[model samples]
Target: MELKSWFYYLITHSVFNFRLLIDGLNEVPNNRDNLLDTIGLIAESFNKVKICCSSRRERLFEQILQHNPSLRLEDLNYEDIQKHCYRRLHTTRARRYAYLVTEELRNAVNNGDDEVVLKRRLGECPGEMHKLFTSLVERQDKFYAKDPKPYLRLIEVATKRGDNNNHGAGAFLTFFELLVASSAQEEFISRVPKSLDASLLASLDSQAPDLKANVVVRCANLAELVPNRSDLQSYPKEFAYKELVNADSLEVRFIHRRVQDFLTDSEEGAALLRSYNMTEQNAVIRLTIASVTRFLATPYMSRVGKSLKWESLIEAGFWAKNGTGALDIIFPTLQARKPLRMPPFTAEDTSINGKTPPFNVLCPQLSPLENVAFGFATGFAMVAYTEAKLRALDLQKWRLVVGFSSCLCVRAYGLGRESSGFLTMFEPYLSLTSLTQNLTLSYILEPFTDVDFWVFRHLSCVATPRPGFHQSRF
Candidate 1:
């Protein structure tokens, strides 16, 4: 059967085809003459069937429907828009706060069509989805205006993940890491808009010479800021929606798909997000650097392995290498006194401090002799050279090893002919023995395995450790 004839057949001859509704006809496009002609054919062919077509105001559709009864839905849908905002607010993480604001908007907008009041109310409670999204962005901007680091950090994250419309929304965890990354002084300094000026950067550097000191505090503050709430709950109150969706997953997402689309697809929304002098290219560059930092620092090594495929890591590295300026800054050489250990997976690990220690524990007994020797021999010099040649991975972790090894090497080499120095010289072999003991569990796994394999290879070549120096991994 002909395509139109088939459509007509289904509409006219089928048991459930008495009514045919064609909607959103105005979205078809500028060259809509054929669409109008087709609609006219369908309408003209209908006798027993009832046709109801809904569309936005368009000249061609209006000309076709000149004599037919039609209704303008923009006004009617305005009320629906109110209901939608109300529903979205109540259904969201900040329901209590949203309800209060939405109620105020409802009362203000509904009280006798005063134009000025209506305009103000619209700003607060948008009468359209796009406007509602815009209003939300404005609200966040106002809220974060005083300390825009977090908000600016958010734009950097979302833009880096690609537009939600094109690549879909990123997981909350992804945003959280990027947010923490944005706080890195090296990364931020490299991309801080010239408009912010060198003076501001210098001032920030004076306070936060090392990014780690303030990174945790900044992350905590940002956690409270986004999916933003006006006031925080005194006690922890988990949202119902978060519970229904896997709340354990740190996936940052837009509240609604349309909201996502608006931010991604609308020029107005992009402008709002990039209102800062920073460009999208610059924002993404900072985000990539931040991500590499966050990944190294996070306690989710196992999770990282599971979540990030080899391709994903490669792609992440590629973007970082190409972002903003070409290779503006490398990951800072980490200084360490102790090796960072994985937190024990057990029930007793309940206390925040107990669950997450400031420094990771290392088994020097598990390192290879050559790796230990090289690490103690050259310190950061060799590690820096190796890092310069390698791709983006956990250069930070290797730096920690090198830093500690260098420190121990100094003490060992300084001891001269002491027995302790001799013992320390054989420490890597002893560590090797311990590693072989776990051969059944993990075949000849070196302590360097804790660092990324690709990174481990780079660091292992220059490896040397004598003994006895505190080591800390991110």
Candidate 2:
């Protein structure tokens, strides 16, 4: 009764129009009578208040609201449904017409037709998505008639897929990463310098936007440059170097997922690949080479120190893992670079480390390529172990070894061992390895006995040093 009085007072006091919407009133379990009374009150105050509600056609509600303005959804919505269907039908026809215009315009430009002639040829014609894509590809081929390999290669990289339809090496490449990858390709390598110095890096950074635009044009609009959300600020400041900032904050992706799907469909994709004379393996290898080249060019101290950059390191490892025989090609190059020296350990150093030096101190510095390889191996191992744990599956022996190895690597890199505690970091993997393998502590200690040996044997095949280069101690 008090609720009814309050609602009555509210409706009476309402000076302007009041609109209320109640959905699924039939779903209300209790207070059916009170709700009906509220509706009656709203009807009495109809001049100032308006209420629209939806409910099942119950007998009680029908008797009360039958005389008032009422609508039967089942009967009254037909006109609305017809209007929606008509709009969709018109939209489909309009899209077909638009596609026809695009196709005709491309042909006209290729034939060097005048604007007047092109305008006349813009009449509606039948077309489909597959036909439109084919037309676009053909236009690109004609545009690059002299040397379409680079154009084709970029397309192949953009659409490359892995086993089980997973994203391949070229997928979701950032603007800078794609530029580096393109430079490493066979056709473009001679044209663009492979090595990037500080000045060159800045120059490329400045020109990144224009480079991206050229890339998109070369790919015939199938690929596009998208903003990199990770690099963007929630509320960006208005500042100078805005162009450079925008370039850094962009990534390359297909304009739409549908474009990727259409291009990567098994039958259509194979035909396209054969037409371009491109292979997924070759594209991945190029990406791997680019990654390694970039990593080698960047200084080690710059990579790990205050000016740290993980892009090259992470990319090198990822591409190398995916590219068959990539390590063989990059290992020599890595060794050719200047070797890292191991710092001398002294009693004072040991005393400062509390009888035992930290892992980073013991391992010292690794060659750029070795650091990438180790980081990749350890990171991959941790991911696999985590997935296995989540799925409640049997932990593999190799995973245990690699997981333990990763803990050591984490410590060696000074990532989080000190603050998080060594035992806390190592205990889970150590305990799991013991429980699952039923191995004695002696066997567990054996792998760490010769860190270099196990790391080379299990984690990577690039452990063999060049004739003149001494391999860094792990």
Number of the top-ranking candidate, with lDDT as the measure = 2
Task: Write down the TM-score for model 1.
Answer: 0.31
Whole-model Cα lDDT per candidate?
0.41, 0.47
**Top candidate (TM-score):** 2
Clashes (backbone N, CA, C under 3 Å), per candidate, total: 31, 0
lDDT tens per residue, model 1, 166-238: 2222334343344433555464445432223345334433443343234323322122213422112222243
Error of 1 at 171 (Å): 1.2
Tens digits of per-residue lDDT for model 2 on 28-68?
A: 77888778887787768567777898888766678777888
**True lDDT of residue 379, candidate 1:** 27
Q: Which residue runs does candidate 2 get wrong by more than 4 Å?
A: 1-121, 124-126, 141-143, 149-152, 155-171, 184-195, 199-210, 233-246, 266-272, 289-375, 381-474
Summed over model 2, clashes come to 0
